[model samples]
Target: MRRGGGGGGRRLPKSSLAPSAASDRTPLLDPHVLHPRNLDLAFSRRDSDAASLCSSRPSSIGTGPSFAAPVTNFSDRASQAAALRVVNAYLAPAVSLRPPLPSAKDIVAAFRCPFKLTRSALKAPGTPHSWPPLLSVLYWLTLLVNSSESGAGGDDSPAASNDLMLYITNSYSLFISGDDDSVASLDEEYSSKARAHAQAAVEASQALEKEALDLESKRTKLTSGPSRLEALQAEKEALTADVEKFEAVVKSWTVKIQEKEESSVHLEKELEAKLMDQQRIAAENEELMKKVDAQVVNVRDVDRMQREIQSVERDNVKLENGNATLEEKGWELEAAVVGKLEEIEGLVEQCNQALRKLKPGIDFQYMLNTKASSPVELLGTSYKTIMKPALNSLADEARRISILKHDESVELEKQSQRNAKILSEKKNHISVCQTKTDEMVARLDSLDVEIGNHVSRCKADARLMKDELEKKDHHLSTVEKESEEFLKISEKKLEDAKRETDEEIQMCARELLKLIDSVTEYKEFMETSISGMRKDLYETVDDISSLASKAASTRQTSAQFVM
Candidate 1:
């Protein structure tokens, strides 16, 4: 016989009851066997078995309807009561069979079952309709008992119990509907399933062993992790030190750069000032050139001086011609006076002769005229009247012409002296201007050389600064890359450590749960064994007391007979 609802079916040793006969007749009220006809047939057979078995024993069965009655016969009230009594007797070991035993509804409620079962349905007519739920309740009770007996702690979970119930129900249905051939097939199927289960168990054990080996290897690796972590920490400290040193160097370089910038700014300002000075000098030189241009003698002034000298010379020539003409006229007038004097002398001589003649005649004839004068008196009168006045006018005209020539000569001498003094001053000014121009040219050349040198130096400084900046940029980039790589490695190690710790915690929790379950089971077993022993000790005491009381009563009866 197989223990229904056990973890696995194990065949018990056959007794003298005959397996063939048991297999030929189905058991009564097997909850998994749902067919009505089969159930009735099985009940009839059970009734016959019970009758045969109880022929020599005292009858303690209830006065319900015979088991040979069909399920349809349970419709009447008396039959319903009888079926209820039968169900109660069958389930007496699992539930109380005393009066006021729990009703179907109370049982379902106690088990927290979704299936509805009422007291009325169990005790009223038409019990066939209530059989399925009742059978389900019986199946559930069977699973609970089997789980408790088997000591499999977690198998009583609702999902596992439900699955086992379905499988058993299906199998029992097939078993009831089939013949001997089907029975043999079911045996074969069970044997095959057993073999398959054994194979799966072996595979599971192998997988567990492999997992254990992997876990052991992982544990060994974890044990070595601290040393690597220490090394990484040391490397990180070294990197930090290097970073600090680099930062310090950068700070120093930045200070130097600031100083260089200040110097460069100063140089630029100096250059601007120099440029302004150069511009101012150039403007002053332009003004000087303009002054020189303004002071230079013009061609028109020289031409005008030459024209005045020509006019003065022409006036001198005219004065000389006028003096010659005056001289000639004076000569001609003296000649004419002489000739006229000759003619006048002739006429005067004639007149004198006539006078003389007349005077002579008069003198000769002193007696002829008393009013006759001398010849000397007549000549004196002629000279005083004409020659004296002509000579005096000519002398005054020559003196006036000499005075005009003397004045013109003095003015010409003064003009020539002034022109020479002016020419000397202009020559001195031109020399000074040429000397200043030479000095300015020399200064410009020096300034250009200085500017070129300064520009070259600035360019060299700029190139140096550029090279340094490029080197600094390269160093910074390399530092950043190294830091990033270190950070990534550190992060990976942290994640791995966290995952390992989480797995260890979960494994410990599972092991603790298993230990708790085993301890609970052992404690329960001890309690049950203790309770059984206590009951046996009580029963032994009761038996001994009863035997002592019997012995005492027998002694008293024997003594009474003796009297």
Candidate 2:
């Protein structure tokens, strides 16, 4: 095969000849050229030379022109040949000497030369050796050569062409047999692709059909107009009712939350006030303790004052006793002085009687002693003056002592009265201080009790508030969870509805496109034939347009709802 020597006559065992691909790339044949045309060019070219079909150069055989251009050029040749065949069949009874021409089927088969060549070429494996292309070129040349030679005037040329045709056909069969497995595999693969494509198309068509039926049913129901409209209105009313009920529930919960917040604020204020009052009571208690301490000092001072007063009373009693003893001693001294004065008076009387008795006797002797008596009289006068001065001084001394004792007694009574008054005043002061201290203690105790109660109440209130706050937080979290779940459910429902709506929209669009294609073809066919039918067709077009517009609007609304 590599030496290019396997061109026409090579053969091999069935297994060794299994076909393989030349390359992974797709073949260059345009499968769109289904039929042939331009019979004149083909026939003229065929008659121009016999040598063009049997060129010995392998390059000339392997690489001719591309198949696309030639196939297009000969597009209508098959129809012409068929027409000629028909004409020939009708004229066969009248004229019988005409040479046979290739039939329409043969002409079409000739046009397919390029495709068959490409397919065979692609099926070869490894190196893109020249055999398949050359074989294809030979296949084409053989057909042209046979077609041209069949109509030749010489009988020997016809037999030669027949032998050539037989040789070419056998060679083509051998080449095909060499690569049979590859061709078969390719055919199987293509068949599978075609089957899959057809299945998909059928499924799509079925889906469109179902959608069309659904749309038709929906249209019919909607066209009933009043009944469907009434049903929609009823649904709207039910939805509005549900919305109102939910709104009411939301409002009530909001109100309850607001009330709870207010209560919490009030409780906070009360607790603050209670704390402040407790602080104040504690301050007052501390002040009372300070005052009680001061009062205790004052009471101690009062006690010292009372003790001093008691000592003063004791001194006053001693002074009073000393004054009484002085009075007794004074009385005794007065009595003794009186007794001594009486004794002095009796001695003076005896001396005076003796002097009288002696005066009678001494009258005789007085004449003699007259001069001596004058001296005695002078001594007596001196003695009497001295005695009077002394007596006066003693009486003045006694009066002074009595005046001092009376002044001392009066001073002692005044001091005793003053001491009693001072003691009573101090006792009254002590009693007042004690009462005040007791009052302060009671007030402090009351304050303590009140402060304790406030503290306890504040603690309890704080606990209650904390519990309520926890409850509120729990309730709020539950509400949030419920709301989230509700939102999720609504979103899921919207998504599902949106998905179904998108499917419906796609289905409608496909159905509409198909309808438009059919309608266009029909309109083109009937455009000039029926003006009256055209009016109805225009009306149908308008209806289709309106339906498309409605479908578009419904899709937009559904999208918005999904959003």
Candidate 3:
């Protein structure tokens, strides 16, 4: 009997279960079996297909859905990057990281081999060691083992194949029926494309992650700029103190300049008065010179007149001695006139000394700089314009005095009058002092106007400083308002960033939980694999023990025959 169970890639040891060892075994199976229907019925329950081996487990939703980066419970943009990496892993064989060409059973499950031919080969208890279509006979038997004898090979052709292997998959059994070349060519194409896709995806994801980090850094710097403005404001304050100090120094210098300006104006006024006094003195000197000249001439005339009068008196004496009393009267009158002339000559010398003392020397450029209203104007034309009239008036008075002196002398011939000329000169001196007082009053009025102009200039400067201070204060206020606005805007942006970070963190956390569940799934898969391994080992052990019994019987037969 060709007996097989779920064994394709699970080959039995023929050395252990040979027909020689089965001499006492049942002779139900034989070579050249014609009953394909019987074989199909026999192996129907034991068809080893790739689909029948692996079973899938149901999964449920596991841990966190929301997760994020450190700054927020927000998903790092890394989540997207990780997603891309995972996708790449799926697409690439080089990065697949699955086990190496899996053991035969695993390959069977993965490829879903479509054929099971082991049941088609027939075998009997005492059949020859070399059987035709051996694998097919075994596979057919394996398929028909669980069938009823009538249903075993009733209509099934699967039990009639010659050479094929079987697969056990979760949904169905499969049998692979391809040559080595085809399988290898398919594998190569699949692996190559998968690796290519994986590499490209991983590269793109890495690039994107780096870009995200760069953007985050740029945002941080942009946010810091507003605070830097505050630092700049502090610097401005320090500079403002320096500016204030400069302003104070400038103000002090301005005050000094103002005082200097005032002093300069006062000095200029004083210089004008001194120039006027010099001009007045020069006029007086010129008038005095003319008066002295006139007095000298008068004295000379008086001397000549006295000499002629004496001559006349001599002639009169000669005649009057003949008429004696008339000549005596004329001689007495001439003596008084000569005495007045001597006194006038002494006064003229004194006036000459006074004229020298009162003389004004020329002052050049300053005099030219002055306007035509200056006494310098008259001096440049002629001293006569400034002084000749006064000298004439003085001369008139002097001549009048002289005439009166002559009259007085005539009287003094009889009365000897001397105090009359002195009294008249004193009266003229008082009148000249009154004219000087009037000139002084006009100079005081001009000085008062200049002082008023200076006061107005000072008031204007003070107003300008006050306006500047007001403008500075207004600018400071505007800057403060703008700074406040900037701070508000920056704070709002930070709040928004904080909110975004928090959301991303939540998303990332969820994704992290999903990854953890994936790990758990992997562990479950490993555990399931271990359980399947234990089951397979148990099956293998049971198969081994059955073959050992058959082998022991064959050995006993051989021993008995040899003896």
Candidate 4:
């Protein structure tokens, strides 16, 4: 496929390109542009994309900034035409007809135009063969050319001088002029801001005036009310008195409540301590019962061992007698079998020699007749003919031996199987025992956790009780102090009241005496009742401990039996 190209433009693959950045010391007025060789080449690329995109393609495309007043006018137009042509080609598939890029007339006309631009104060030719910096400037300028709006770019750029920023405009723009420092413009902005602030202040003053007038009117109404400062003060004083009276009553009530709570806490602590004691006793009883059960288990184990030993002794005696009798019989049988075996060996040798001589090629009877030896004659006789009978006997003996060996092997296998079965049973028993131990350990751990939690709770309760006791002590001290103060304050009044209310006081004294006598009697009765209750509780605790001990003993005994 053929691809379109833009005039005075170049194409570069990003991957094939290397960037050359300028050093900090390089001046802005450097006269370097894109690589010289890259500038002579037409904008063409292969191996990758070939689209007619309006992208920047820098290649030594620059002229002196001073020459921009003449060249930028027309050169930029030519560049624009080329760019437009490329853009048209890109959109040709969608829009069939398009005008050629800015015609020659437009390029010529643009050269005669004028544009406001910024110029750097630094002189060009600031460095020699500063290609590195020149390339860097071109890189920055290339970016500017590519991104500029309306394509307002050429070899010239906006001057760095402060005077350039202001009065800067495009061909038909009224941008801010450049003359003063940035601070001057900032000052102007601040001045306008100050004016706006003044206007805002004026408006705010008007609003504040209305608010002040409204506030003055509200003040007038507030002054007109009948509730004076002194009256408010008096009301506040009355409320304060009520608050003090309520506070005093609350204090007294709280004091009484605290005293009652203190006593209850002490009583609760006593009850908890008693319960703990009972539980501890029960636990100890259980432990003792477990020990007793262990003793029983040990006794049972001893009896089992003794019985096993008796059985083993009996088996040992039986095996010993059987071994001696079997040995004597085996010796006698061996002697008889040995002599018979020698005779059978001689006969076998004789038969083998005769069989070799009795080949089909040779007549055995003739060979025998020619030999005429003792062995040969014997071979041809009845004794030699008995070889078949002897061989049958040997076969039978071997069969008997094999049968006996097979029987013994079978018996040995059975015995091994039985022993293995017994061992498996023992292993199963051991595993069962281990499993029980693990379960017991789990139970013990659970019990320990429960006990730990209970202990922690008991400690917290004890601390709370101690706090209550301290609070009670503090209240008691406060009461004692207040009573002392009251006695001091009312000593004279008390004497005078005693004199004036003597007759009523005597009646009150008599009533108090009777009340005291009744209280003393009640105290004695409560003491006796409390003592009886303590004794009953002790008995109950003991009985419960005994029951727990019995239960523990039963459990232990049962466990031993299971083992």
Worst 10 residues of 3 by lDDT: 67-76
Candidate 4 lDDT at 348 equals 69
Task: Please write out the lDDT profile of model 2 over residues 1-563, one tens digit for every residue.
Answer: 11122222222213432223312212222112211111112222111122332232122223433333212122133433333443344445664545688753365466655432223233542222323333334434443443344334223321222223333444565467797665566556656866897899999999999998999899898887678679899999999999999999999999999999999999999999999999999999999988888763577788999999999999999999999999999999989967965665566667556556633223211111223336464224543554456556767887999999999999999999999999999999999999999999999899779867766666666667667556655645554554465455555544443444345345434644564566576677777668768888999999999999999999999999999
TM-score of each: 0.17, 0.17, 0.16, 0.16
Which stretches in model 1 have alpha-carbon errors above 4 Å?
1-165, 178-211, 226-240, 255-263, 270-563
> Which sequence of candidate numbers ranks them by TM-score, best first?
1, 2, 4, 3
When superposed on Cα atoms, how far off is each prediction in RMSD? Answer: 54.7, 55.3, 51.7, 57.6
- For all candidates in order, the CA lDDT equals 0.56, 0.54, 0.50, 0.53
Model 1 Cα shift for residue 196 (angstroms): 9.8
Q: How many clashes show up in model 3? A: 75
Q: What is the lDDT of residue 68 in candidate 4?
A: 21
Q: Count the backbone clashes (under 3 Å) in each candidate.
A: 0, 12, 75, 13
lDDT of 3 at 13: 24
- Which candidate would rank higher by lDDT, 2 or 3? 2
TM-score of model 3 vs. true structure: 0.16
Expressed as tens digits, the lDDT of each residue in 19-138 for candidate 4 is 333222132222233222222122222212222111222112242212121011111223334334434444456645366767433543454322111111013323222222233333
Index of the highest-lDDT prediction = 1
What is the Cα-based lDDT of residue 346 in candidate 2?
Answer: 69
Q: Model 3, 11-65: lDDT tens per residue? A: 2223532224233322222121222222222223222221221111111124222
